[model samples]
Target: MIIQAVAHRGYPKKYAENTLSSFLKAVELGFSHLELDVHLSKDGIPVVIHDHTLDRMTNGTGRVVDYTASELQSFRVKQDEHIPTLEEVLRALKGKIQLNIELKQMGDYYPELEKRVLEVIEAFDMLDQVVITSFDFDALERIRQLSRDVRIGLITFGGSKAILDWSLEMGATFLSMHYAFVTEHYIQRCQDLGIQLMAWTINESSVMKQFQEYPSVWICTDELEGFMDVLEMSGSI
Candidate 1:
């Protein structure tokens, strides 16, 4: 079969990344899952965004945590998009797509970050439709403790046997990684263990071909919708 595409930060190439409009566009394009980054706003609300600092994605320039949700709204994302609250994004896409929320931890904000994400997910009653991802095992474990039904992914920038072993022990539902880490052997190994593999930030046609050969290779990318169009045209994916 084909790999399931998880649009990274909701197809950043098409719409402003991580905004409600962006997420809706991916859902409308038939993406069953959309990936997003979560960070606590200045007032402890969970907001959908990818950067610790707002300089890249928004009009304002400062740490995300430095601005309260109200302050964050004043700075628009590119193309005049308001930074939608996580609650708004979730509700907009509710019942339409599974959400993969990557917790971009900054220093010791693990406990607080985990708590805020849980609060919003619970508010939407979407604990079942979400998969929490993080490189911080402590934060992942802490979230694991907080919710039994919510699936979790252990985020890794690089691949290794040791990390694999730990991911198994941690009962991670998915192994999310940088695109370079995906391979035939890696796919086979995960199959043996009944684990799903997901790669992040992929954007090349050749790289997408390498992934298509392995169906277990789920993926997240900003250019995913465009890539899907190419695959359909070529009849390769």
Candidate 2:
């Protein structure tokens, strides 16, 4: 089986998560897919970062939405890397890799965030190369309303049939779930339903070996090298 390893947050083990440098490194390391998060800045621009707040990942100390894209860039991630606008990431990785852009929303959704994100993807002409994902069902519905051609994925922590049904209802082609919840039965169900499954943030060698039996499932992980090693060990590379 071929292992499809998606660089989660662009090789977070080596570089600061979600930074352009990390993304470039992932690309350079021959990863074909990368996953990143998107949140709207105060000025309505989509910026690349995982959290609603910048306190953990950067030198800043407040909500990311409180600052404009320019202001947010002033804060350094790991004291050197600046927060990247979504456009910057798209421009840099346009042809190099496929992107899984998660519409990150906690508590309240961003104003017109789905529309704005679509606009950016359209501007880059990357609708075919990117899949917009979200844990928010409403946000995914909003995305469907705006564009029919762009692909959508539902990010869920639970491995329930209801979640799968809801994904089908919304015409989502992909379902991203936490790796721990994924089972052989679950993989078969996804395959039967014609929906692709992405196992998120998987780093363990045992889990990596287990997933190798199912070539249809994509593995999203921070340890790109570790996944590669597993592939090599199995002579599947």
Candidate 3:
């Protein structure tokens, strides 16, 4: 399979990251996959927000779950964008791109997260369009334990052979990793094991160059134009 360009939080510097407009812009640029964050709202609904606290990303005054989905919907996100529901995002990106929805349930919030996320995805009839990821291996485990259908990805701050083994046991189809932890040997290991390797938040040309030099490495970047230009010049896109 060919590597794809994924928008990081939806062209963040220019548009509101994780909002509907931001995601649409990425799709317009021909990016077929997007990396986004999912957090539980006060009513146990899954909303697409990047942080646990809403201070930085929205006009809200507290934690994400502190506000109901309707309460959050009215709040102005960065650049005055509405806090988009996961349903809106799925509808907008429907047939446009694959979504890598990173689950960030901390403390005791993981209880309904698996059900809410899977329910939304299932309602949209988008089992193939969605991939769930988390730094919390237990979250991935629970999501996997819920069903055999959903595709799961392991995102990590670091990695090792043991971690990879654990990922396999959890039934993950891909590993989203930091660029520092990825290497030729690791890539080979992934390929040998029939798993895809995707690295995130790569916004610089230097990292793209490194990924380009390696075969079958999927790099998710925010600089879509710059990344495409580099890839075109190097014949790597």
Candidate 4:
């Protein structure tokens, strides 16, 4: 069994995270799985970004929901990088690889985001290859309501079985969680329940080595090439 690698925000070390350049870099590096974050704009467009506010990643300062998609185009992630619409991302990476689209909606509910994201994915014919994930259990529920065929994942941080229980209740087939929560016992339980496990933000080689035993688990990482090197040295890749 070989552990799979899921590029977190498409190789953030080489390009700005959640941008087209980053995703393209991930594809060039031969990564089959990609993870990204999405937030709905004021005009109901799902934009690819990690934060609720634009200040951290882009020149803009307001909450992402306050600005329309077109308005966000003016704010630059850098001189060359601008905020990308979810449609643009879907078109760019459409047939190249599988995607994990993390919904960024937390407290302020955006009722149309789930519908809009599904619409974009449907247009691109990527429904089967995509997994919709979020820390908000309600958001995952909404996604389940919209389409049972679409894969839904629960993103969590702690090592509690309650998270798995809630994820099961939401009909989630995947659990995306912090690496610290994963254990042999937990992995076995998830396998028993038929839930696939994915560990997030794993960058260290030592930690990567630790998860090699779980061949089916997907390890999400920022250092895509480095993780591959670890696997290569271990003769696992």
Evaluated with TM-score, which candidate comes out highest? 2
Query: Over the stretch 1-237, how does candidate 1's per-residue lDDT look in tens digits?
Result: 333788888867878888888888887778868888888887888888888889998878988888889999888888589887788888888888988898988557634898888888898999878889888888888888887777888888777788778877777868888888666787788788877788887888778767777767786778865678667877855
TM-score of each: 0.92, 0.96, 0.95, 0.95
Q: In candidate 1, where is summed lDDT lowest over 10 consecutive residues?
A: 106-115
Model 2, CA-based lDDT: 0.91
lDDT of 2 by residue, 1-237 (tens): 323678999989999999999999999888878999999999999999999999999989999999999999999999889999999999999988999999997536698899999999999999989999998888889999999889998998868989888878888889999988888999999999999899987899998899888888999988888999998999878
Q: CA lDDT of each candidate? A: 0.81, 0.91, 0.83, 0.87
Which is the better candidate, 3 or 4, if ranked by lDDT?
Answer: 4
Model 2 / residue 83 / CA error / Å: 0.3
Candidate 3 overall Cα lDDT vs. reference? 0.83
Instruction: Please report the TM-score between candidate 3 and the true structure.
Output: 0.95
Per-residue error for 93 in candidate 2, Å, reads 0.6
Backbone N/Cα/C clashes per model = 0, 0, 0, 0
Candidate 3 residue-wise lDDT, 1-237, digit = tens: 223777888878678889898888888888878899998888988899888888998777888888899998988886469888898889888888889999996646646887898889999999999899888877888899887889998887566898779877877888898888787898899988878888877888888887887757788888878887887888765
Model 2 TM-score on a 0 to 1 scale = 0.96
Please list the residue runs of candidate 3 whose C-alpha ends up more than 4 Å from where it truly belongs after superposition.
Answer: 1-3
Candidate ranking under TM-score, highest first, comes to: 2, 3, 4, 1
